[model samples]
Target chain A: MTLAASPHHILTVTVENKPGVLSRVAGLFSRRAFNIVSLAVSPTDDERFSRMTIVVDAESAPLEQVVKQLNKLIPVIKITEVPPAEGVERELMLVIVKAAAETRGQVTELTAIFEAKIVDVGYDAMTIMVVGEPEKLDAFSDLVKPFGIVELQRTGRIALPKLARESTRLRSVKTARA
Target chain B: MKLTGAQALIKSLEMEQVEVMFGLPGGAILPVYDPLIDSSIRHILVRHEQGAGHMASGYAHATGRPGVAMVTSGPAATNIVTPLCDAYMDSIPVVVITGQVAYSVIGTDAFQEADTVGITMPVTKHNWLISDAQDIPRVVREAFHVATTGRPGPVLIDLPKDVANAPMEWYWPEKVDMPGYKPNVKGHPRQIKDAAKLINEARRPVIYAGGGIMLANASNELRALAELTGLPAVTTLMGRGALPDEHPLCLGMPGMHGNFTAVTAMQKADLLITLGARFDDRVTGKVSTFAPDAKVIHVDIDPAELGKVRLADVPIVGDLRTVIDEMIKALKSERSKQDPPDLAPWLATIHDWQERYPLKYRQEEGGPLKPQFVIESLRDNTPDDCILVSGVGQHQMWASQLWKFKLPNTWVNSGGLGTMGYAVPAAVGAKVGRPDRMVWAIDGDGCFQMTAQELVTAASERIPVKIAILNNAYLGMVRQWQELFYEERYSEVYLSPDLPDYVKWAEAMGCVGMRVDTADDVVATIEKANEIDDRPVVIDFRTDWREKVYPMVAAGSSNDDIILGPEFGEGGR
Candidate 1:
């Protein structure tokens, strides 16, 4: 498959839970001039392994080249590309907006529409916790920019492959029977 | 039985059958040095850590085995960085062991503490910083395995001082179970079939061989395929000896300074069967215009190398030996159905190019010595099986162009990295690897000055490697570039011929030194140097500085724009 078709590529990399693995992976990206748009890492259910959700800008480097180079690292166990359409992805963002008394009502209504939670209330600002796909988070941030975001933190992205649909499973079963 | 981590490290190396290692001791690595006195592996103390690293690379290049190098941390670790990068670029197998500060003081910036692994992450194939003393054996085993497998590059192991001194039970791991590291050794059957079909259909085909053939020890298979299909092959600088120079189908080295026939053949071929050779910029010139008409069947062990610079019609990722064998069988089966394309016309075209623009030079009797003539004399006088190592420069290009390499593993140089000062130490390492074979390091005066101190190590270790310095008294390649492209604006290229008196320097280092200034003395000096067996010999051949390597493709230009030398009449295009 041609990897240059998409600008954004999400790779779920499984690596050994050894020391300096994160640095090695990050160093590889910087060394090869591959732009890492977003990256999140956490230990897997198996203590010996860790899973890294890496979102890369494919325009900076070809996705196939990035994947092949990552696979060569001895600590990396496996790399699976999670296509945006075929995978379920989420990002967590905490934004403190300038919601003074005059704009507090409007900000509350906007948060309700997006189903975001107001985790903290302050004199001049409200801290909103928004968890959704990267695209949804971007939309929320753009809308809140008029309210003046005082502080912002995005927990980059984490993803998993979507479950197969029941209809697709049924069709596969029928084909096997045939 | 319990043993120190350093002892376990030594024992593990012995288990891996490492006979010799090049290194020097320092404070951080002092613990590891203590056990070396009892170890069976012979350690050659080097004048510099860079020398140790290059020596290891030389040994690996000469013997086709992973070379070992050890050094202390901080500056020592940093010193070997060039060789590590060089090995990585050229896919040479070398395992470098660097001592680190004690585990407790690792982050405190204690004396002789540097993050060796972090600094070398991009250059090495793999690396490990030992955290536990008990993990020494497994890490050593993994380092050796990773360094020797797949594309085979340098690997590093940073051993902390505390870990080296800590107690641990030594047990050699029977099997390495690295889930992330499995090298594919067999080509897919379908890809093999497609490659064979392409081979059978092509009219003008050239076998583009590279260092990977020698790394895979598949030279025999390459020769078999070339002979079977009656195809002409062009070897890159790294692949010089993969196809013997005397072989009828061998078209010699092809690149910026390659012969006219080899470069033009690639530029004009209809198909290129690329075997273990990457489309390096030097060999390809301007990538967009490289072999514009040819369909490439690229095979490499590294998957990333395929479709990297140029797209391959059929990209086969596997070991070259197995892939070539499968291709041979597949070609034979396909031939049963239809005959291969006739290549007589293509062969004749290449022959004409070879005849019209062969590598040429001029040297009058009793006049100034020419570097090319000196190389020819050395090649004629040296043993047929001698291993010729070289530092990077005009001297290196001349050696690659002029030497008649008839065997694999005989021609060694820093091709991908173009590292200067690689010869003298590498020669010592090469001689150590194969003492029975004569090792000659052809170096330039500028290159010789960079690491000439390594001759002391060679002399002290009794390595009888001979060195022939093409003393042109300039950074010859750069000066040539300045002369041609920069309009004779020679800036900082000249190194005077009389600086430091090479004969006296060689004598001080306990080596037999000789000098030759005229054409008549070239062969006699080389013969006399070749006769020395007890110690190292250094021959300084003062040659004319005006000569430049020809059949040149100016950087960033098309290979079609190659300029033959002045011998080819005015404007020699």
Candidate 2:
């Protein structure tokens, strides 16, 4: 079987919500020399479990090896890979761009075009809260860079498997039966 | 049910049926020692924490039980890191307990405090830092369960001093609640069938048995499979005793220092039915050229090891014993449907290779004692079931090459990590674990110097483990490499023959010590050392330093390029 050619592989891992569990997962990646492109972790629906969204650079280590090694950790419950094409991924970025009176209208127009919200407005700067797919967020960041961004931060990325779609033929068959 | 955490910890050990533990007490662990005073479990106080860790590993290797070791935090904890790493690499089930500073002072760098959990996280299968006194029994249970299951490995439990001193209601944990830690013990039916189909189809199939066979107690299953198919088998270094060395189909060890036949069998095989063995670089030299045309059927308990190196055509994740049993049944059904492949030609080829490049050495009369000759003599003199342990170096290679291991759990050494100074303490623990069997540690002078002080513990405890030091007056393996690879520059590898005076050191440690310089005295000294049963014995054998382990595939070189000793004449290449 051929290895996944994608440089970035996103993995959703559920682990026991115990102290040091995060370090255990993080330690494993660092020691095994698997480069983590981005990581976002938070409590899951069940308080006893936590979900970790880890995006790893597959060029440094094979995705199969990374998953297998992570599974070996006692605290890790389940690991599911969310391929870029098969999953819904979102990233939130908060940027304080230099929006003077002249460029304020342009910044607000740009934010509206990107469907971003101005969470905090300063005398000379505006903190724009933009939430979208990582790629869209990257495009927005590039569009706002010309307005002289003062500070920027992205909340990494969180993902979930896309809902399964009903086949059109099956739907048509159900409709005919109805 | 009210008890201090120390008492609960000792009670937990008793519940686990732990017979003995190796450790030394310190201020942080003093409370734990108090409970040990009234405990039934025997605690063998060691000279150093490193000794304790290795002793625990040796016990595990010898008895097939998770070995127990306890040490204080900070320096003491750091001292045992080598053994923990060694056990991790070799997959020995060792449960180490370390005393930590008070929970409140843990980050304050209190006296004798260390982040034991953080330090050992990468090396252990799992580790815990117990904060609540009530968590003692469950954590202990989990530690043992994790350490002994799946691919067996070392685990640690760091108990804070305050926690150990705190009062707690003790109750035995009937079952472990590790939701995420379930080890797959049985093979998938499809994988098993696929493996059997490959086994039945290949004429040049080699049963590459590894340490997993012994760890899973599947030597009988291995023997059954090898006999059923008439397939030749090669055991790796860690897999030394999995198949009896004298078996007709056994091709001895296969690796960098492996025998010519074993190395060549793997290189020329059409199918490699690898069990419980990883495709380590040492075994498959320059993997790109290893078994160029072979289809691998890799079986291991750990799914991670399946495709870690060479991808397997059939990768079965299960305990070796269970997987092999399934494979045997599957093969029987397959064989009944179609005739088994004719392996006579393959066997004949292996036999020819074995005869042409048999392991050879020369020991002239009155000449300096050859290390291989000493190992052979020991093999001849020792009991059939004696447990032989060795430290890392040329002596370890020589011992692995020369000794005819006939029983499982009879050969122990630092195979993966190649830790020096493993022999003395490990032999002591092995003897303690198997009091019925004779335990001999074959050590090098350099290795002996590392942990030879453990002899004092053996002497004081009256554990009659025998040791034979192949004192070659140099770090022999490194010296050999310098000689061959560096134009004989001979840097800092030499350790003068009589510098520490091993005999005097042994006597000072309260043990009988003997020295043999000539070939004639070798057997006599060994025999005499064997007769002593009251206390530990150390025999210093001044061996010839010029000899090198042969049939070597140099680092990163292909197995096809195995270098034989001069005994092979012009065919040495």
Candidate 3:
């Protein structure tokens, strides 16, 4: 029988904003050997709490177990697993590539095609910023790999569920129209 | 009322009805200790920080309440790590408080500062670092709540010295605001019905109960389910005493050192109704062949445990008591049917296995006393209500196999982590919690030497726990393994029998210690130890070092390959 690999899952965890809470969460993932592909953390509107968006490779560990363990942490206020299709994900990438006078035109044209902006330019290299979905960033990175890239960095992915009207409200509105 | 953070912490513990706590005091924690002078909570000063934590866990295991331990920073915090990990592995509810350097000096690595929260993060269910004085009450409430609920485990609260000294008006939180930590306690009706249907349809069914039954206080429901369905039940090491050992349906423990009947029953089972038990590697020997033909009905409070190792035909995630109650109700309807499926043939086969390969050990006329014989003598002499705790080794397995546990929470060993030096302090904690019951710590010489210092605490505190050291001279379990797997080339497994005479050592700690070398002295020595209730006593029974725990399933092998002892005649290893 062929093995069916599990997909990567994105989990959003909200926790109380206290000292060492981040360490506690990160410590749990490390202890369980669960790979955190990408992670982003920021304080919520309420200063008392913080929200973390974590992209975990479910293929390496049991996702359900990971979520259950996350819930056991006291400071954690909530957890939600956003399906890839139902969520909007974005990442920021900065790539510094070799762009001598000879390759400058080709690099600029490729940057334009990807809708990226040139952030900085040195004598031998040009640094460009790309902001888009993770997949788009991956594609841009792949396209720039052959240009003798000097440096690359990415702001790990952050995600939120796509907004939609409640089904009950939509149903009521349709009934009223009818 | 206006109060210091230390006073507020004490008051909050009083509000939680904490009667006893175990710990040691040091410089950073002196502020908290000051408030304890006026508080009603009785604090037992431990010999070591690790003893404090294990004592608290022992209290939790015996009383089914969250145990409390408090210690100072740096070395003190680091010393308690073993107990925290032990509690985590066993899923015991224990709340440990450690002192930290002043909040202002946290990142600077000030004197006696060890990043307590950082070190304990992975082991605890949750933890907090108190920076604000006002956060004390809420943190205390949340700590206890998180420690005791769901899949219970240890929780830590690190109090900076500055926070303890900071003054604020204490106000307890009315309710905990943990939205993510709600444990599912009610089984779905459809799943309960499905589990009942499966239970009713199977011919060779077994109820595999684990520690969850005791955690949920569902032993009565488990017994009722087993008796109502006329099904045999086998417990995991942690699940021992969920049903009275004498109960007709009880098949005792099933795992690495479990009885022959239990091992074979699981191998041949058609359906397994597992409750509150994770399929740990030890229990599911060679997972591919474990309960090979059984359709599983896995029920546990933690959803992760349901399919962590093996898939369940019908998974029920909820509190064991609640789920068992629902299953009983559903099974009651099925029981009303005129022609219930007969399990007589299955029970007869199990009876044959039980009778044919009963846990056996024989002593040559006047030869060395077998460890199993010693355990049997202890069981025969001790009161039925006495509590038995053991350190991990051949002795622990012997106690688990030979001792007939007839009540819940009576057998308190380090089951999950298998910590070697758990018995002495744990027994002391149990005796402190249950002053009316007799407590015994059955240990091996190797295990006893690890934490024997705790006897000083037990003697000074007047906790009258009995320590029965099954002295085999060698690290018996490791020696047996070396003999079987490593071509009998023993390394460092041997400990000289003359070193540190246990009796003299016990006397140095103010305990009444006795040495029994012959089988004839076992009963009299145990009785003498039991007679003394004013101070702790240690009885050293020199058992045969060559004897090994039988019905052994070689590590990582299938349960089908259980090697019985020579006494079994045909299946000698």
lDDT of all predictions: 0.93, 0.93, 0.90
Question: lDDT of model 3 at residue B16?
Answer: 88
Candidate 1 lDDT, tens digit per residue, B1-573? Answer: 899999999999999999999999999899999999998899999999999999999999999999999999999999999999999999999999999999989889898888898899989999999989999999999999999999999999999999999999979899999999998888989999999999999999999999999999999999999999898999999999999999999999898999999999999998999999999999999999999999999999999999888999999999999999999999999999999878898899999999989998888787678899999988898888999999998999999999999899998899989899999989999999999999999999999999999999999989999999999889999999999999999999999998969998999999999999999888888888888999999998899999999879999999999999887888886
Give candidate 2 regions above 4 Å deviation: A1-6, A167-178
| Clashes within 3 Å, all models in order | 0, 0, 0
* After superposition, candidate 3 runs with Cα above 4 Å error: A1-7, A44-48, A162-178, B337-339, B570-573
CAPRI tier of model 3: medium
Ranking by DockQ: 2, 1, 3
Sorted on TM-score, highest at the top, how do the candidates line up? 1, 2, 3
Question: Runs in model 1 with CA error above 4 Å?
Answer: A1-6, A167-178
**Which residue pairs show backbone clashes in model 1?**
none
- Per-prediction interface RMSD? 0.7, 0.5, 2.0
* Candidate 2: tens digits of C-alpha lDDT, residues B297-408: 9999999998999999999999999999999999999999999768888999999988888999999988878999999999999999999999999999999999999999
Candidate 1 lDDT score at position B408: 98
| lDDT score for residue B466 of model 3 | 93
Worst 10 residues of 2 chain B by lDDT: B564-573
TM-score of chain A of each: 0.89, 0.91, 0.88
